[model samples]
Each structure stands twice: as C-alpha cells, then as structure tokens.
Target chain A: MNYSIALKTLVVKEVYRFVRIWPQTLLPPAITTALYFLIFGKLIGGRIGDIHGVTYIDYIVPGVILMSVISHSYSNVVSSFYSTKFQRNIEELLVAPIPNVVILLGYVSGGIIRGLLVGLVVALISLLFTPIVIHNLAITLSVALMTATLFSLAGFINAVLAESFDDISIIPNFVLTPLSYLGGVFYAVDMLPPLWQTISLGNPILYMINAFRFGLTGVTDVDIKLAYLMTGGFIATLTLFSLWLLYKGIGIKN
Target chain B: MKALSIRNLRKTYHNGFEALKGIDLDVEEGDFFALLGPNGAGKSTAIGIISSLVTASSGKVSIFGHDIKADNAKAKSCLGLVPQEVNFNQFETVKGIVYNQAGYYGLPRKLALQRTELCLKQMDLWDKRDTVSRRLSGGMKRRVMIARAMVHAPKLLILDEPTAGVDIEIRRAMWEMMKTVNQQGTTIILTTHYLEEAESLCRNIAIIDQGHIVENTDMASLLARLHIDHFVLDLADPLDSLPVIDGYQLEWVSDKVLNVAVPKEIGLNRLFAQLSARNINVVSLKNKSNRLEQLFLDLIDTKAKGAHA
Candidate 1:
C-alpha cells in the first residue's frame, strides 16, 4: 500500500470539505473568538486589572486560543466522520486497502490542521487587542498540536457511536462546551473557591489550557511538566481507543 | 483462475435473521454472472460479505488468488462494487467523487486524474463533472457511481441493481456501457430485480430462494430447462372453443387467437399437423414471455412449494 498517497487523499478530502463550507466551519470560530476578545479583553479587562502579573487580556489569550483549537478539532472530526457513516460513504474506505492506522492518522491530521489554523486565526485576532508573547515556542506548538489531536480523537469516538445527528450534537453541547467554559478559558482556577478549584483541577481541559497558558504567558497553577505528560497520555489513550473501535467496527461495520 | 470463489458462506445477523445459509459459488474470470433472489433471499447479504461491507458468520471468499482473510488488501484491490443505493458524498462534484475513489484504491494523483476523465467520458458523465451530485437527476447520480467504481478499473465489477428505478433508455445505455467494460476482460457480477436485464446481459445465472441456492447454471442451460414454451398463435378463423391436441395445451385467448403451451420434446410439426386436420389456419405465433423469466418464476415457485411441503 502507498501510505503516503492514501494519507494525502484522505487529508485533502477532509480539508476540502471544511474549506468548501468556509462560512460554516472556518468563519464562525473566528467571529466568535473576536467577540470574546472585544467584550472580555477591551470592555471588561480594564476593570479586572492584571492577572498573574500580566494584563487581563494577555492572560486569557492562551485560553481563548486553546478553546478554538479544541472546538474546531473536535467538531471537524465529529461532523465529518459522523456524516461519512450516516451517508454510508465510509464503505468506500472500508472496502479500500488503506490500513486502519492510516485512516486514523489521516483524519487526526485533518483535525490538527483545522484546529491549529483556527487557533492561529484567534491568536492573530487577539494581537489587535493585546500584545502577545510566547514564553516557549516549542511548548506552544506541541501543546496546540496535542490538544487538537486529543479532541479530534474524541470526536472520532463520538462519531463511531453516533446513530443520528442529534447524537453527534449531544456530546459537544452537554459535555465539551461546559467543560471548556469551566476549564479556565476566561479565569484562573486559583480565583475560585477552594472546592471549586479542586474540581477544576480534575478537569482534563484545565491541564490543556494551563499548559498552553504556560507556553504563552508563562503562568499556570499546575506544574507544566505534568501538563505535557497529560497531553501525551490523552493522545496515546485516544489513539488506542479509536483504533479499537474501528477494528471492532462499532456502529460502523454491519 | 476464478474471478471469485465463495465456500460455505453464511450470515446470521445480530437479530438472528439468517440472510445466507452456507451458500457456495464460483465465477470464472471474464464471465458475466447474475445472482438473482427475492427480497430477503440473501442476494444483498452475499454481495455485502464479498465487498467486506457486512461480516459473514463463516465462509471463505477469495478474489483471483488472494484469500480475503489472509491478504485482505490484495483481495479487495481486485474488486469494485457499485451498491444498490447512492453511497457517494452528495455534496462533492462528480469529478471529485471519481477522483477520490481512484485515490482510495491507491492510484497516484496523475493516474487517478487520467482515469477519472476516462471513466467520466465512458459513463457519459464528463459534461456533469463539475456539478455537485445533489443537483443531478437520479439517473445521472447512478451513472456517477458507476464511473466512480470503474475509476480503478478493478478486475471484477459488482453491480447490485445498477439500473434499478432508471428509465428504460438510460438503462439501455448503461447496459451498453457495461457490455463494453466486460468485453475489456473485466469480470462482471450483477444482482438485480429486473430479470430481463439479467437475461440480456449475463451469461450464467444463480437463483437464491429462502437463503438457499435453488439453481445455478449457465444462462442457456437454465433457459433450456424450460421443456415447455408458451406461444400466442393468431388464427385465420375464430376458434369455437379450446382445441384438443395430444401433447400440447391449448386455450382460446380470443375469437381469433389461441394460446399454446408447446412442449420442447414434441415437435411444432405435430401441433401444426393436428391444427391443419382441424382446418385451423395459423396467422402468426410468438413467445408469450421471456424464456428466462419463465424459468426464474418456475424455479422460485417450486422452491416455495417445496419449503411448504
């Protein structure tokens, strides 16, 4: 099998799908992130003053960037893959000779590309409202890539188990959005009540956001090494789970 | 080598519905084979199993010389399936759908592009290449799928009701297209509700009923099994009633027409001699229905009766 050609075609198909519907997939995240910067950064940051020795707007930039990465990555795979199953187009791939791992990696790469692209867009948008600086370039890129892969895999799992359009929406609405909002996209967990702060510590999104924050503003409540470790662990666990689901043909095979 | 081989293939769905019951089949390379069955008789299940769309309970299927279990990729590489329904991305352009399918089969970009163009032209879809599939007519969409499936030029092409719901003219055109494809040394396997289509295109036939292969034989041999043929004969004079022939069954269709079920073993000469003695001049005689259709019905009907017995 020519893995390179197969991977490229899958990735290209994925990218073309979202790009063709730019208004739906690409523009909404940009506009939503811009609104966040305008309202939270300019309208409200003045009163909140500084956070962790930096301007309030600067503090939330990393969180906002991670939020876009997570949302775009997850939604891209969930929507794209679930539609493939729903439409029965996955039969094309199932009958093809491409390896299961290549399918997984190809879709994940698509999610990563969309997630990082949206993340970059949000970051550039943030620059107009706040001066941004990256404390660790390596950490920032890796964390972004890891976060995208993590959610993209989650989306794939959701798609495999999803039987309808409503099933796809349930996860992003009830679980992902709530976890992301409370995951410290706007405020540091340190400012919350001790019990709430403890609960926040348990949220995986917190580790991701804070790790990305450490790379951006050089400030985080948790150890940065633990943050990277959590990212790696999530990738490994999700990769294994996704591959197993594909092998079992869960909700996909007859 | 056989284009396809299936041995003891069986499938019991999760709900315990046995779609196939240990069926075995073989198709010689370059042969046009028809797999015919009633609505729940397991034609789809057999095709699904061979295409790897549905899991079989127990069976061995090999394409060419590659075993599905041992060499899945190589086995799949030799087969192409156009499903009974539309399965392509509805939002993608016709050209894009064909190009991507070629790529999925591991064709490089340049070769994929060339084949995409060739298939589109062959299927008469080149003019609609830029149109998204959702915008095309139902017949056009089906053609796009055919083009997509043939993009890789697989050695074996399997079409399940490829012309179902298509208009007669369009169906004829597709039949012509597939004939050309088959003549190029590609084996063709088809399952269809249209018995006429199968009788017209396929050289060999298999009839499945209640999850069993009731009959499998060459097309000519199967039709030959019809020891009786029914012909509608127009008479120069009005028949007063049904005529009495020793070996032939005759019924008056109208005042001037007679329906005769002629036995193949008994000569039409005998029937003509008997009619002439009765002073009945024959104006014209023609077959009552397609020979294969008669045999297909008789086979399925006999199986139904045997099952009840």
Candidate 2:
C-alpha cells in the first residue's frame, strides 16, 4: 500500500473538514481573544503594576496565545473525531488499508494546524494591544506546537471513550475549562501563595503556558528544562495510550 | 483461486450470544455469490468479521491470499465493503465521498479523481456529483455508496443489501453494472432480502439460519431442491372448466386464470404442449411465488424443526 497517499488523503480530509466550516472553527477564537485583550489587558491591566518589568498586558500575551492553541487543538480533534464516530463514517477509515499510526498522525496533524492557525490569529490580535517581542523564537514555536500535539492526543482519547454527543462536551466544560483557567493563563504562578504555587506545578498546562511566556518575554516562574521534560513526557505517554486505544478498537468496532 | 476463504469463524458477543458458530465458507474468483439469512441470523456479523469491522472470537479469514488478522492492510486492499446502512458523511458531496474513498485505498490524487469519476458515471450518479449526499433521495444515496465502494476496484466486493430501498429501474441498472463488473473478473458477494435478485444474478449461494449454514450449493442445485413449481397462467379465452392434464394438478381461480402445479422433473415444456393440444391459448404466465423465496422459507423452517427434534 502507498502509505504516503493514504496519509495525505486523511490529513487533507481533516483539513478540509475544518477549513470548510471556518466560521465555526476559526472565527470564535479570534473574537474571544479580542475580548480577552479588551477586558483583561486594557481595562484590567491599566490598574495593575508591571510584571517582571514588563507591562501586565505584555506579560499575559504569550499565555493567552498558548491558551488558544491548547483549546483549539483539543477541540479540533475531539469534535472532528467524535462527530465521525457519532455519524458512523469512521468506518471509511477503519475499513481502509492504512495503518493505525497513520490515522493517529492524520488527526493530530490537523489539530496542530488548527491550533497554530488560531494561535496566529490570536497573536495578530494581541499586537494591537501589546507590541510583539520574542526572546527565543525556537522555544516559542516548539512549546506551541508540542502543546497542540499534547491536547490533540488527549482529544483523540476523549473521542474514543465518548459514546454520545453529551460526552464530548463534558470534558471541555468540566475538565478542560477549569484546567486552562487555573493553568496561569491570566496571572503569574509566583503571584500565588507558596502552597498554592506548589499545587499549580502539578497542572500540565502551567508548564506549557509558562514556557511559552518565557519564550516571548524572557520571564518564567518554572525551570525551562523541567517544562520541556514534563511536556515531552506527557506527549509520549498520551501518544502511546492513543495508539493502543486505536489498536484495541475501543468503542469503534463491535 | 479463491477470492475469499473463511475457516472455523466463531463470534460470541459480550452478552454470551454466539453470532457465528464456527462457520466455514469460500467463493471462487469472479463468481457472484449470495449469503442469505433472516434478520439477526448473523449475516451482518459475518460480513463485519470478514471486513475486519468486527473482531472474531476464533477464526481465520483471508481475502485472495492475505489473512485479515495478520496481513490486515493487504487483506483490506483486496476487499471493498458496502455496508447495509447509509454510513457515508451526509454533509459531503457525491464526488467527494467517492473520491476520498479512492484516496484512502492509496490511489494518488489524479488517479483517484479519474476513478472516482468513472465509478460515479458507471453508477449513473455523475449528474449529482456535486450535490450533498443528504439532499439526494434514498435510492441516490444507495448509488453513491456503490460508487464509493467501486472506486478502489478491489478484487472482492461485498454488498450487504445493496438494493434495499432502490427503485426497480435503478436496481436493474445496478444489477447490469454489477454483472459487467463480475464479468471483468471482480468477485461480488451480495446479501439481500430480495430473493429473486439472488436467483437471477448469483451463481452460488449460502443460506444461514440461527447462526449456522443450513444450505450451501450452486444456485441451480439449490433451486433444483424445490420439487414443485406453481405457475398462474392467464388464458387468452375464458374457460368454462379447467382442462385435465396427466401428472399435473390444475386449479381454476377465475374464468380466465388457471393455477397449475408442475413438478420440476416433468418441466413446463410438456405442460405448454398439453395446453396447446387443447384449444387453450395462454395469454401470459407468472410464477405463483419466487422459487428461491419458497426454498429459503423451507430451509429455515426445516432447520427450526430439526433443532426441536
């Protein structure tokens, strides 16, 4: 079998699926990021003192962009895959000759693309609020793409386990929303009390947002190497788990 | 060479229901075969297992030469399946559905596009290529699936009730297309409630009842098992009384219609000759019932009776 052609087909279908509905997949994040900048950066940051010698708005810019990446990546895979399962059209892929890893990468690649696209849109909106600065472009791009990959895998797992439409939304609302908010998107982790700071380290999204913040503003509350280690570990674990779920045909095959 | 071969296939669902009871079957290359059964009699389950959509508890299934379990990709490459349900993305256009299926089977974009167009045109769905599948009628949706399945041009194609809701004209057109495909050396396994379709198209047959194969034989041999065939004849002239014929039972249903029970061995030729010997001119003749349907019912009934005994 021609693996390249099959992989290209799935990735193209995945891209086409979201791109065709740009109004829903691409618009909401731009609008939401603009509101965040308006409310948190201008109205709120006007009163707060400088953070790490930078304006409060500039300090939160990287976190806000990474937040969009995390959520968009997660939402893209979860919704696309769950809808395929719910519609029973996943059979088209299942009955094909492609390997399970190709299926996994096809979906994850789509999530990465959307996550980055939405991140770019949010970043463009941020420039209107705060001037762009990059301390380390490599760290910035790596954290953003890795974070997207991590969440995309999570979404695939959630989709496989989901049996109904309601199950798909439950994770985003109950789990993901809380994690994104508590992961230091709007504030610095060091600003918290010591014990609370210790608890914040356990949230994986914290390492990603802080690492991304370091890449942008040269300021971070966590160790940069530790952040990479944690992110890489989570990605590896999730990738293996997702592939195993597919190999077992959990919830897909009878 | 065999197009498909199954050995000791068994499937016991999580709830302790045995959907397949170690069934073994095979179909030769280029043959049109039928797998007939009632609802819940395991036809879909068997099809699912063969397509690798359902995991078997214990069995081996190979398409052409590749084992479905060990050599999944090659096995899948050799097979195409059109499921019993409308399983394609409803939002997709007719062309996109078929075109993407070709891509999934590893056809490059240019070839995929060409094959997609050819398959759609063959299935008579070219005019509706850009229409979203949901907007099409039920029969059109069925044709779209056929086009999608045929796009890959696999060596073996299994269609589960391909004509369930199709109109008669479209169904006949599909049958002719399928016959042409079979003539081109692609094996087809069809499952349908329309027994006449099986009688007309399939060369060999397997009838499954209660998770067991009760009959497996060529179509001619299976139909030959039916000892008697009943025909309703419409006479050109109204008859005052039914004519007596040796070794045949004729019943008068109306002044112009006669129902005759003709044994298979004596055949319909002798009866036609006997009627011509009389002054009776037959206007038209039709089977009292589909012969395959009658035989299917008998096989299921006999299986049930034997289990009780």
Question: How many steric clashes between backbone atoms does each model show?
Answer: 0, 0
Off by over 4 Å in 1: B233-247, B250-259, B267-284
How good is chain A of candidate 2, measured by TM-score? 0.98
TM values, all candidates? 0.96, 0.95
Which parts of model 2 have CA positions greater than 4 angstroms off?
B235-260, B265-283
lDDT of 1: 0.91
Top-DockQ structure, candidate number: 2
lDDT of 1 by residue, B223-266 (tens): 87788988999899887788788988988779898888999999
iRMSD computed for candidate 1: 0.8
Best by TM-score, which number?
Answer: 1
Residue-level lDDT of model 1, residues A1-254, one tens digit each, is 67688889999999988888889988888888899999998899879998889888898889999999998999999999999998999999988888889889888888888999899989988888888888999989989999999999999899989999999999999999999999998898889999999999889999999999998889998888888898899899989999999888888887
